[model samples]
Target: MSGERSRTDRTTLLARNDLVFIDFDGTISVTDTGIAVIDALELDEAWEIEHQWRRGEIDSMECLTRQWGMVDLARGAVYRMIDSFELDEGFNELAEAAIQIGAGLVVVSDGLDFYVDRMLGRLGWETCPGEEVIKRPRRCIPRFANHGRVTDHGVEISFPHRSPDCDQCGNCKTAHLQRLRAHFSRVIYIGDGHSDLCAARFADLVFAKDALAEDFAQSGRPFVNFETLAEVNEVLLAPRTR
Candidate 1:
C-alpha cells in the first residue's frame, strides 16, 4: 500500500521514536561500493553476471556469489581500494540531525559487511573503538548485510540475513523492516538501487534517488526525491501537523 503524506506539502512527519533504515551502496556513497570493488579488481565477467541479474535471468544471490568468486585480489589489497571511496558530502549533517532527534539509525544492505563496515567506520559510525576484530564492525548503526571474511584462499561470502522464502536477494530488506515494525511507530527508508525495492515499499516514508527513485515512481508510492543529505534533512526536519 502507498503511504499517507503529512499535512505539509512534500514533507513527512517523523517522530522521535521513528527508526530510519538506510541503504549503504549507491544511496549513502557516491557509487556502489560492491561494484566499485569488483571493478577495481578487474572482474570483467562480473558485469555480465550483473546484466543477467538485471535482465531477470539470474537471482541476486547468484550474482553476488559469482562476482565475489571472480575477485582475486588479496584481502589487504581489497581493503586499500575500498578505503578510497567517497561519500555524499551532506551525509554527516543528516546523521547528526537524526542522532540529535533521538531517532534510530540502521543500515540495511545486500552488500558485503566488510566493505560496509569499513566505509561506515571511515565516517566515524563505529560502535566502539578497536572492536573491529574481524575487519568488520560489531555493529554499524546496528547494520544488517551479507557477511564477508578473509580466508586462506580468498574472501568468503556468507549471507546470515538471507531469507529462506525469498530467493531473489541475498539479504531480504523486506524481512529486516518487518522485524523492526513492532519496535517503532514509524519506519523511514532511504535508498538508491534495485535491492532496495522490497524494503522501500514497507517504509512509512521513503527518500529515493537514482534507480530507486524510478522504482518509486513506477510503484506510485509517495516518496521524497533527494540528491543529497541536505535535502533529506530539510524534509526530515519539517514541522509535522500531528
Candidate 2:
C-alpha cells in the first residue's frame, strides 16, 4: 500500500469513462484460492481436473464441480484456509485510486465467490456501515464469480453468472465484459491466468501477467505487462505529458 496518490492527481490522470475490471485469485491474491483450497484439503485429483479445464477437455463448471466433490473437509476448515490467503500489497491503493477518481471498479473472477467475498471483506470492500454517517463512504466492489457453498458432504458449486450458451467458463468473464462495455466508453482489464483470456481479448486495455501474459505474447496481442498492482496503479495515475 505504498505510493499513495492524491485525489486531485487521480482525478486529473484517470479517465472518467474507464471501467476497471480486475481478476481475483492470483492477480489480486498472492495465490489462486481455488488451487489453495484443493491443496489445503489434500485433493490430489483436483489438479488433474484443473488441467482438464486448461486443456479444453472440460468446461469450468464441470471442472469446479468435480474438484469440489473431492473435498471432504468441514465448512469451518475451508473458511479458515480461505482466511489465511493474502492479497497483493498494492491492491488497496489501486482500489482507493479507482474510487477517488470516480472510476467504476469491478472485480471479475473465474474463481469461486466464497473466497472472493472473504478476501474482499478484508479490505472493507464488501459493505460499508452507512454512507450518510461516513465522510467518504467506501464503495462495495461488485464481484462476478462462481458460487460455492460448503456442506456436510462436500463443497457444492453453482454458477449464477454462467452464460446459458457458453460452457467454456462457469462465470463467463467475456459475457460480463460485453455487458459492461455498453455503459463504459473504455474497459481496462487486469488479470493473470487462463480464465481471463476471453475477457482480455475484448477489453479496451489489458494488463496481463503469468499465463495470460504468455498467451498474449504468443499471439502478438497488445497489452501492458505488469507483475504487481503497484505497476498498474502507477500507469493509471501517471501524469499525462502530452
Candidate 3:
C-alpha cells in the first residue's frame, strides 16, 4: 500500500499495488457449496427457495434465510456431505502470487462463513471468528460474508455485513469493495454469479465467469473472461507491458 496515485496513470499504479477481492461459491470452489448441500440433503424446499431467488420473486438474503430452515440434517452430516466438493485447483497458486507481490487479497464472498472457514482451514490457513485469515505479510484476507449455525431445528443464518441500501445480497460485496478502495489504489474483483454484479462495477478490474461474465458483457463492463484460477494468476502476475 502507498500514497494515492492518479487514475490517469492506472497502468503503472495498478501494476505494482492492488487489493484483490475474490468470491468463494463458484470462483474458489468448483461449484456453489450451498447448492451442493441442498442437493446432498435432497431438500426440495431449498430448491424452491433457490428458484424463487433466481426468478426475482425474492432476494438472496430472503432465499438463504428461508432455505436454512429446510436443512434439518445434523451439522456433522452436512459437513461430511459438503466435504465432497472441490476447490479450484489454482487457488493456492493465486494466493501465493498475491502474497509474493505484496498485494492485498481478501475473499469477500456472499457464501456462509461456515463453509468458507472450513475451506480456509483445510488450506492450512488460520481463520478468525468472522472467517478472517491473515497468512503473514501483514495483510488481511478476511472472509466477509454471512454466517450459519446448525441446531436441532435446522440451520440458522446471520447477515453480519448486510447492506443498508441493498437487499439483493445477504452480504453485499459492493459495500466491502468500496471500503477497500479507500486504502488501495486498485481493486481487482473476481467472481462468477449474480451476487457479484454490483461489486464488479465498483472494481478497477474484474475476472468473471459463467453468469457473471454474461452480465458484464450485456452491461458493457470490461472484464477478463476466466474459468480457472490459473487464468487469473497468469494475468495478474504477468509482467506489465505498459
Give the TM-score of each candidate. 0.85, 0.86, 0.85
lDDT (10s digit) by residue, model 2, range 127-174: 322111112234576677788887866678898887876779998888
Return the candidate ranking by lDDT, descending. 2, 1, 3
Count of residue pairs whose backbone atoms collide, per candidate: 0, 0, 0
Model 2 CA deviation exceeding 4 Å by range: 1-13, 127-138, 239-242
Report each candidate's C-alpha RMSD, comma-separated, in the order given.
5.1, 5.9, 5.4
Model 3 per-residue lDDT tens digits across residues 11-52: 522243578788999999899987887877788788888888
The model with the greatest lDDT is 2
State residue 183's C-alpha deviation in candidate 1, in Å.
0.9
Candidate 1, residue 86: Cα displacement in angstroms equals 0.9
The local distance difference test score of each candidate is 0.75, 0.77, 0.74
Range of the 10 consecutive residues with the lowest summed lDDT in candidate 2 = 127-136
TM-score of 2: 0.86
Clashing pairs in 3: none
| Alpha-carbon lDDT of model 3 | 0.74
Compose the digit string of candidate 1's lDDT tens values, residues 116-232.
778878888763322121122223456778888865456788878778778788888888788777766788999999899878988888999988899889878888787886677
How many pairs of residues in model 1 come into backbone collision? 0
